[model samples]
Each structure stands twice: as C-alpha cells, then as structure tokens.
Target: MEAPTVTALQTLKALVALQEIDVRIRDLEKDRQQIPARMKEIDKLLEEKHHELSEEKNQLAEVELARRMLESDLKAEKEKIKKWEARLNEIKSNRDYQALSREIEAARKANLGIEDEILRKMQDIEDLKTSVSQKEEDLNESEKSLLEERTELKKKLDSLNADIAKEESTRAESLGQIDRRWLAQYDSIRKRRDGVAVVPVLDEHCQGCYMGIPPQQYNTVLRGEQIVTCPFCHRILYYAKSLEEMSEDKA
Candidate 1:
C-alpha cells in the first residue's frame, strides 16, 4: 500500500476544521433566533396584566363619581325640605297647610330613596377598591419577573452574537488555508447535504448516509492519496485513524 501524501493529509485536516466551525456557527445562530421569541412572550404577558389593572382603576373612578353625585343630590333634597317646613308655618288656611304637609312628605320619601342608593354606591366603591389593590399587587409581581427574564434573554442574545462573529472571523482565516477548488466544492456539497460536507468512513461504512462503502473506494480512502466523495450522499469522505492504527503509531 502507498503511504499517504503530506499535501492530501493536510487538505483533509483543513476540511475537517472548517466543518467544525460551520456547525458551531449554525448552532449559535439558532440560539440567537430563539431569544426574541422568548422575550416577546414575556412582553405579551405583561401587556395583558397592565390592561387588567387599568380596567380595574377605571371601574373605581366610575364608582367614585357616582358616589359624589349621589351625595350632592342628598344635600339638595335636605335644603328643599327645610324651605318647605318654613313655608308651612306661614300658611293661614287648613287646606293650604294640608297641601304643604303632603308636599313635604313626598320630598322626604324621595330623600329616603336617594339615601338607599348612596349606601349601595358606597358598597360598590369598597369592593372596587379591594379589586384594584389585588390587581396592582399582581402587576407588581409580574413586572419584577418580566424584567429579570427580559434582561437574561438580552444577555443570551448578545453572547450568541459575539460568539457567531468570532467564529465567522475564524472561518474566514480557515478558508485561506484550503484550496479554492476544494473549498468551493465543499460549500456546494454542504448546501445540498444539510450543511454536512465532510464525514468519516468507519469500518467501510459511509457516516454521511450509513451506506456500505465499495471495497475499491474504501482502499482509496485508507491510502489517503486522493480526495473521495460518497457516491450516495456526495459528501467528502475522511479516513479516521482507528484505535489499532493509533496504538501501532505510538509504538
């Protein structure tokens, strides 16, 4: 068997290194993609909570306004009763006195009805206050957690971006070491083969497609004298040193 040439072995090493860089870059980009979706989910939850609190406050405002208006009506009715009482003493005829008395009774009945309505309004106002307090508490708790989560997501996204940038620079340097024709071929193959351009041949099996390699192709790969591509997946085939081969080399 012919010994492997230095140039061929060096090309294989470069290709392997380039593949590692590409894989990591893809993973980091995927992590970066996930950050925004998670942050958006947190924001959506907070928005819903904010709306709930606002609605409760608005309800409280409406209840308070009703209570104030009712109080004003009560004051006006009391004043009317006082004026009617004074006018009763000034009446000279029995018929006039009786008519004034009836008018006063009607006014007092209306006042009683207004007082009952005021009491009901006060009860609603108290219930609304409790609801507003509970909603505010819930919002505060959610905001604290949302703030923490948003911060963490941003940090993760920044880290991923930094890592991806570093890897891209490294990949550019690695491209310079590889033959242009080989690099071009690798890129073309990766585009069609799920970003996997190079794979190991283990025990006559093509790792890319898990297909059995032909005996002639297997021999060429073991010799490492030429570049070989898998016929099935069209991925560049690499010959990995076996445990026995490594042991023998050490000895």
Candidate 2:
C-alpha cells in the first residue's frame, strides 16, 4: 500500500495532537469550573445555617424578654398583696374583710398565671439554646471541611494549569509547522462547528455525521488528489485505517 505524502502525514499528526491538547484543556477547564460551583454550594449551605441560627437567637431573645417582664409583674403583684394584707388589719366590718380577701385571692391568681408563663418561656429558651449549640457545631464542622476542600481544589487547579501551559507550548510549535492556508481553513471550520474541523472517514463513512460516501468521493479520498470534505457535514475528511489495516501496518 502507498503511504501518505510527508505533508499530509505531518498535517495529520499536527491535527491529531491539537485535538488531544484541546480535549485535555477542555476537560481541565470543566474541572476548574466545578471547584467554584462546589464552593458556591457550600457557601449557600453555610448562609442558610447562619440565617437559621440568627432567627433562632432572635426568637430566644424575645422569649427571654417576655420571661423578664413576667417576673417583674409577679414581683409587683406580690407587693400589692402585701399592701392588701396591711389594709385587712384596718378592716372595720365583715363586708370590708370579705372585699379585701377577694382582692387578695385575685392578686394571687394573677401572680400564679404570670409564674406559669415565665416557666413556659424558660423552657422555650432552653430548647432554643440547644438548637443554637447544635447549629454552631454543624457550622464549625462544615467550615473545616470547606477549608480542606478548597485547598485540595486549588492544588488540582494549579496542576491542571501547569499541564495546560505545557500543552499550549507544544500545540503552538505544532501549529507553526502546518501550512497557513490549511491552518486558516481548520480554524474557520472549528470556530463554526464546535472545534471539530477535521474528521476521519471510516468504513467508507464520514465519522463526523456517519453519512456514507459515494463511490466517486471514496475514490478521490483514496487517490489523495485534494482535500475532501464530507458533503453532509462539510467537515474536512481523511481516510482512517481500519483495525485490520492498523494491525497489518504494525506488523
């Protein structure tokens, strides 16, 4: 079998290398982008935790204020009871004593009610304190995990960036050796079609779109007369060796 011309072979090699580097770069960039997204997710979770904690603390404060107010009211009621008892000493009739006794009973009931409310508020405050402690613990743990994750991601991004720099240097060297017109054509097609300018023709089919090649076009590709394009996809085409052909070539 006839070998491809030196120019064609070089162009093929360069294109293949360019494709490799491009794929690596694209993959690395995707990974890099994921770092930010992961951090954003962590940030959102932390923000939600903070907001929940803030709301809980606010509720606790309100309950505490209510408890204090209830205590003050209880104290004032006790004071009123003392004054009523002193007035009972000066009661001049059974009617007056009965009226003072009724007033004392009402004050006692009101004080009991205030005490019950204060107890409920204290219970609520205790529950809130527990919740706040748990939330803070969770926040601390998450923050630690986030810091470690950020460090790891940063290391990976740095390594990928180094690889990209090396690959870029190699790609530039390879690109310089390709014919200007062919490079221009490749770039133009790649820009228009998702960075896939050249595609292999395999099994008498265009790999780009899996369209069958007519006998005439297949003959021209075999002849290597000129650069051929797939009619369906308009991508520059080259004949790729089959597995059998590859084995034979290797042998």
Worst 10 residues of 1 by lDDT: 1-10
Please report the TM-score between candidate 2 and the true structure: 0.82
Give per-model TM-scores.
0.85, 0.82
Model 2, total clashes: 0
- Clashing pairs for model 1 are none
Summing lDDT over every window of 10 consecutive residues in candidate 2, give the lowest-scoring window.
1-10
Tens digits of lDDT, candidate 2, 1-251: 22344455456546656776777777777777777787778778778888998999899898999889889888988998999999999989999899889989988988888888888889999999999899889878987887788788778878888887887888788786677777777778778888787888777898888999988997676555566778888787776653234347668
Model 2: residues >4 Å from true position, as ranges?
1-6, 223-225, 241-251
lDDT of 1 at 228: 90
Error of 2 at 140 (Å): 2.7
Superposition error at 181 for model 1 (Å): 2.1
For model 1, residues 1-251, the per-residue Cα lDDT tens digits are 23334366567778888999999999999889988998999999999899988988898899889989989999998999999899999999999999989999999999999999999989998998998899899889889989998999998988899999999999999887788778888999999988999999999999999999999998898887778989889899888873235447658
